[model samples]
Target: MGFELPDRSVLPRHPVIVGDEPRQSGSGAMFCHLYPANGQPTGEVAGAGAADVDAAVAAARAAQPAWRAMNGDARRDLLLRYAAVLKQHAQELAALETLGNGSPVMMAGYAPMVAAQRFEYYAGWADKLRGQTLSAWNNPAHNYVDYEPYGVVGAVIPWNGPVFAAAMLLAPVLAAGNCVVIKAPELAPYSVMRMGELFLEAGFPPGVVNMLAGGPEVGAAIVGHADVDKVAFIGSGGTARKVLQSAAENLTPCCLELGGKSAVIVFEDADLAQAGQMGLSGAISVSGQGCVNGTRVLVQRSIYDQYLAVMQQIAGHIPVGDPLDPGTVMGPVISEASVQRILGIVGKAREEGARVLTGGQRLDGEYADGFYLPLTIIADVDPASSLSRHEVFGPVLAVTPFDSEEEAIALANGTDYGLGAYIHTRDLRRAHSVANQMQAGMIHVNASGEGMQPFAPFGGMKQSGFGRLGGEQGLLEFLQTRNVWMNLKAPQ
Candidate 1:
């Protein structure tokens, strides 16, 4: 049986758009979207190439002025209207996401809710953008700092959470007064095109929000364009390097949100029930597909055995079934290729000294057609092993035992990545102290994966990628600061 989309009536047509009008790829090619759950054809979109990207950039470059000239209040009003439409059509978007990536329907639905929330959040900031006046700092001169849009922005969004990521990037970028040409990645472009249509329905001006489809060529076109001042890319580490190189050719700035191999530290003093709940939540969230998922588990030796048992039981019980089934907590990975990659990593861990406490294979029989994997935990793991140091991006957790707080911190912060980390403990003072020592862009204290507010900035340090994606920093990413200075007295 074929996987069914919850609602097909709201589906958008194929072909990339340039200034509100749709056009096929230069050679009239199309990219067919397949349901990752069952490998069925769900929809098709225009396979945009360099030609389409160039046209989109040109359109956005042309429309930037008028869009910037519009009052921020007017922009905010329009964005608010779009936010309403997003909430109204959330279910449709959710179904589309599940179809694209095999994300569980329950989790897929949240993408819309989060997207709506982010849009609403950024919309509120539209009119609140401010520049600084520093006349007092500059003697005999009046100095003012103005934040201006970077004109056309090339945003290449990832496939994991297309709607949410796109909305997160788009909302603040638009609020900052930059017109955008969004290049939907290989996995999901249909939902983005649909959102573009929604933006049009909300009365956004043509060319202000453009959509492009295809592969790396399209992305290169957008990022390498002479007129496109900056690019925001979300993807793999290798892919990020390529994007950076492209941006370098144009001397265009970039915001890169890449991969992570985060850690979750559970102290002996932590509430076991609460810690288990939160720990498992991080491990199996989106089947561990999330970038900020706490994949490394460091437990205090005092309660290591007991906590390991709890985790094993938790892993054994998590549901892995159909994405459409509400009872299924975890769904398949995005594609069979992804399933193989995850399994390959697990196999390598097994070949090494790491012992599998539970689950090291794919689910078959009833779930044969889809890419389903049970939660896997590798205990007796070396903190420096590939399994512990690298990102599995699957429902695999690497648990390491630590003797003291110093060892725990060392093991937790061993990896090169510093995206996000979690600490679970009942001692408020200890929690604060440990959290302060944990090196991550975002930290969760006494819990796992809590406190991701739109008002707070989210990004990473070191190789995990730089630049912020939310809050005031997100808006500023699309803007350039200009200093205007005037002499108090006329020059002789």
Candidate 2:
């Protein structure tokens, strides 16, 4: 059901989640969300401070036991109700994201839709949680094992995807009966802060979920809080390292979904059109701000030129304009500094001999003040070049060609990152062969759309990050295994 905003055509503006309500931030600094479409300040929100972080963690600690004591059926129903709330307010949430993060409204809308679906899927598993019943070896022993929730989870969100992040980060934890203290994405904190109100509206007990809007200092506080049991972080590699170090001081288990310099491998037998589409999606979608954007693409020598041509056409047609416009296919990157940083990366790649197949500069004339970057495809990039080695985190695609299956595999696995990779080919044997050797945690085999579902395992290998965040595996991450043993009075 669609719900109308009582405030009428607006968001909470500068909302921040504190316990079960949307409250003004007491961090003393006002955060204004600027519209990247035109470089205009659209809204503001309260930022969290160290004190706020302490308050949130304390609230979550106090509420965890009661929340866990409630039967699974009750938790399931509450989550389902939350899903309804998400669905009802999807439009407003989408708008808030666009105004703050520069994501197109349509793309922003999909996040919440995905969130609601995931909530329902995880809700179904709440009452279905199973423990293993062990067999005895004629020794009069009765043994079994059960799962229990970690008392308080501290989750740090990334700015690129807010609504969807909440789904993957919170659904499984909540499904397992744990309370959470979220460090809301400081870059785009408004919409998530608004989510604070839905907790009570969805009938969840107060303190079950709390959010704070602050920078790295607040995040450090969450990780160091003695009450926090685990930390879930999704951001850059550098930040993940810091989070890991801090969480280690307290021996808190941490789930890191860090940066990626992933590659898209398009084989000779792959459909050129489909490969081009995936190429566009990997580097162009969300303005390539996603952690798993396969900016480095390795196409087989036989199809390399054709695939490049298709990619050029795709690049030319990608709409760049106001994020609020329904026709816009691409929006500006997060900020003006981001625009300059991406431009610098492109300039360095050109200096290192990579040819700019299409756009390589920021849109100047009409889009002068905004953080606008035209779609750019850098062809003939060296595998060892900085463009190919590091995460650009912008709308830049670097292409290289490989001659054989072995070379393709080498190219795909060469990077330090192992978050995600894409493979486009028709032969099942080749697909399986290459996939077996690919080092990434998640591989899209001739498919697309982030490779995520409520029940699918999603994470990375190597420096990209660790720990799973979906399905039974995700549910398990939030739980600890406990063994129960008893001696039978008489042998059965």
lDDT of 2 at 163: 77
Instruction: Encode model 1's per-residue lDDT on 11-110: one tens digit a residue.
Output: 5674477787865443335677767677666666667877777788889988999999999899999888998999999988887787777888888888
Q: Which stretches of candidate 2 lie over 4 Å from their true place?
A: 1-9, 489-492
State how far residue 217 of model 2 sits from its true place (Å). 1.4
lDDT (Cα, 0-100) at 57 in candidate 1 = 88
Each model's TM-score, in the order given? 0.96, 0.95
Model 2: per-residue Cα lDDT over 194-302, one tens digit each: 6766777787888999877767788888888878999999888898888888888899999888889888999999988988988788767899999887788999998
Cα error, residue 84 of model 2, in Å, equals: 0.7
- lDDT values for all models: 0.83, 0.84
